[model samples]
Target: MDCHNYITVFPERKRGQHLGREERGAIQQLNKQGYSLRAIAREINCSPSTIMYELRRGTPLRKSHRGRTPEYSAKRGLAVYEMNRMKCKRPHYITHCSDFVKWVVAQVRAKKWSLDACVGHARLHQLFADKEMVCTKTLYNEMAAGNLPLSLFELPEILKRKQNKKGTRKHKRLKGRSIDERPDIVDLRTEFGHWEADTVIGRKKGREAAVLTLIERVTNNYLAIRIPGKNSESVMAAMKELHAEYGERFSSVFKTITTDNGSEFEEFSKIEAWGSSVYYAHPYSSWERPVNERHNGFLRQYIPKGVSIEKYTYEDILHFADELNSRPRKRLAYQTPEELFDAFLDKLYIA
Candidate 1:
């Protein structure tokens, strides 16, 4: 180690400790002896940058005394270290945004909104200035550090994330046409009217009510209609009602829809004659329709499994879908699904 750059010496270095007075003195001595920064660090079992920073931080000006040569002083280094020690404490500003925090907590608890959604939406709307609001990570860190009133588990998605289960690889029957034949434009989601459909059931044994959901691929517009049961008839009835509601515009609005191989959607392929196209996903492949599956997870926050959806009225289902559609999505550049969907409609009809 003392050979000092004449040879490269590899040694086990001290890790993650602050600079000490002894290290500073060693730096001064080695530097005075014409040793390079790397050589000094190798001899003292530390990093070259540590030596370089310490030299920069503590080296004093000697422009008058040495005509521009400034020497490293151990006494000066220790004094600088003491000065940096005083600045070690950073003020905790998590409490500064109390109002914003309350609004975020309320939205999470009442609306089942995600933290990132709440933060991003607020920022996009200018609800709070830079100093008045904390980032999503900072809010999570506040919960982690116990500086906040709530725990991470109190959030809707946090606990459910760990509980996500793999679906059965059971036989999934293919109906009508395959999604493989569907246009690539549906996947790109740039144009409107393409949708992914799914059925959410309640109380596997005794429940008769289910939610027939359709999310627009482009605008992320979510539609959840309460069906009579988890069967082909119920799904078909709901689709007919949706067809009747939009009338002439129905075909244009729902240009194409992608569905899973659930028994409930077995007769769903009948919509092919109704002008809008219907396509089926592959067996046991939920990833093929990612946006639909993700929104289903969000719906689980309201209509949890093993509970009866029969108890909730159709109006209640509409309200739940409305809330979800109104919430801003990060993928949509912080725009709400309802907003984007309406804009698309205006473009299609008015333009």
Candidate 2:
């Protein structure tokens, strides 16, 4: 009969689709029955050249009475196709950037650096060539795919948070001036001396150790001091030490400080008499001092919640604060807070 009859028996193959095992088997059976290459191509909805190539690849030497003869095997064609596909896959960047990947893992484990910070710091310093490093998104993807050594828990501030209802609650009493009275310059974060203050407590029990935290609005320079307890007396004592440390430059360095109406900061307004303005946020409003709250979260990475802060020495607390200050921030153009803060101090003293 006619070769066109075979086309009706087999379903038409889509253009550019690779030949499957079933199609290959059909090619062998048709070719055995003396079907022309062009006729077989029409049957499978492929080109004549594709049939010719498949025949060459699928045909192998077969032993017979008249020496070795070539015969097409569907199994042979599929094996060769799979081998070629494996060889044609795109190479992963991890192989070429092995050194950079290793360094990233080390920093995340040893220094507790965020993946984005690691990538940004490396790019800012030109620590590696363009071909030798992947983007931060790729790094996180590799971690998710289990290609990296680090785990999700090791990353700071990467956990999901429960959504809470947002509303402003009125406080029974105001400890000091309200944040409403704070100057607009403080909100803009363009000035250098405006700061946000807060306290991190270890446990809810009586007389637990706490940490006093302060962060500059502009440079995000962080200062953390371990104190005896979360009380106004302890908070003022830390402030006194800071005032003494800054000495003549205290007023200029700490122009304004915004804090919450916590009992720990009840006596904090006294700093105004020492030359700096103190503004108090509304009750249950932590967002008013976001920078300090965020840095306190970073501090939690080293000193976890519910654990006594007294377990860590004063030097350990200082080291944690220093590490935070030395970390590169994307908002700071990949520069460390310490670098920008020191530069600002230099300019202030020279003026």
Candidate 3:
């Protein structure tokens, strides 16, 4: 509709009429010379931009005549209208359009290909080549409506790649109380001091016993710690130091702690003097305390499990925590978790 925005190239000709051979010859000659597009356009009495586009496309002779020209515009419109009218009278046989559906399904089955990916590929590479065609989303709607035999939910099977097996400590042996006892406010995250905790294991082959770990919840932000041991005393001592160093930060934001039933957290009451509540996760659902699990994974880069943390200084752990906090998180819309945690604090009623 916006003719001014686009440089209309060739005027529409009668449907069967091709470009004159002489016109094609001229394009071929000028292309061989490598004359400036503007100079060629002036020689041919056409727009320079048109010449440039044609050259970029290797100067193929134009054959199709579809859109408006001063003479045939009305005829083309009427022809399109008649075709659509006839098409509307026919019963839909969308299942016959298996090629299109197969293409969509193939893309969905590919690795890491989301709906967004499918939509983008269809628009950029398929539909937009003919500007009049429906968009990818429109195609999806029609496909869904048709209820073709293809299952949209089933993605193609990727080769099964083995991942490092995460170790699970026996929760039954963990000394901490069950998560059910945690206050309701902690669940809502409306108040601070409720934290989820976990540990990230080291590399494959059980190389080290170093623990990169932390305790944090909605209201409180915590720096990571490398504990020398996985015992209850080591965990309790690290938490005690965290509370002591960040007394105000802890008092305000640190209200409750939730952790998987790891025996490392057996001494749950070590920081009870800090007035923070604590609870334990159920069996096999450590994702319930996502923050701790997330931070634990991060610590794997530094003080991984099975490694000796005894060799690393407190400063080393502190710096690692700094880097971890600085790293961007997708959950925070590319904002660093450190920034999100701080912003969350400013919004909370700190004690």
Shift of residue 309 alpha carbon in model 2, Å = 1.7
Candidate 2 lDDT tens digits, 1-351: 568645556566796899998899999899999999999998888999999999988887556668657788889988988899899987778778999989998888878889999999999999999999999888887777888877789885567574564686874588888899999989888989999999998877878788999999899999999998898999999999998998989999999999988889888888888899999988988877888988899888899889998898878889999999999899998899999999999998899
Where does candidate 3 stray beyond 4 Å? 1-174, 201-209, 219-222, 302-311, 343-351
Assess candidate 3 and give its TM-score to the true structure.
Answer: 0.46
Q: Write the per-residue lDDT of candidate 1 for residues 1-351, one digit (tens) a residue.
A: 386557465344466688777778778988999999899988887788988898998887665754658888989989988998898888677778988889998988878778889899999999998898899898877777888767676675766644354665546558878898999888787888999999998887874889999999888899999998888988889988988988888889999999998888888878878799999988788888889998998888788888899889999999999999988899998899999888878887885
Task: Report, for all candidates in order, the number of backbone clashes.
Answer: 0, 0, 12
lDDT agreement of model 3 with the native: 0.57
Best by TM-score: 2
Which candidate ranks first by lDDT, i.e. highest?
Answer: 2
Ranking by lDDT: 2, 1, 3
Go through the candidates in order and give each one's C-alpha lDDT.
0.86, 0.88, 0.57
Candidate 1: list runs displaced more than 4 Å: 1-17, 21-87, 160-172
lDDT of 3 at 286: 70
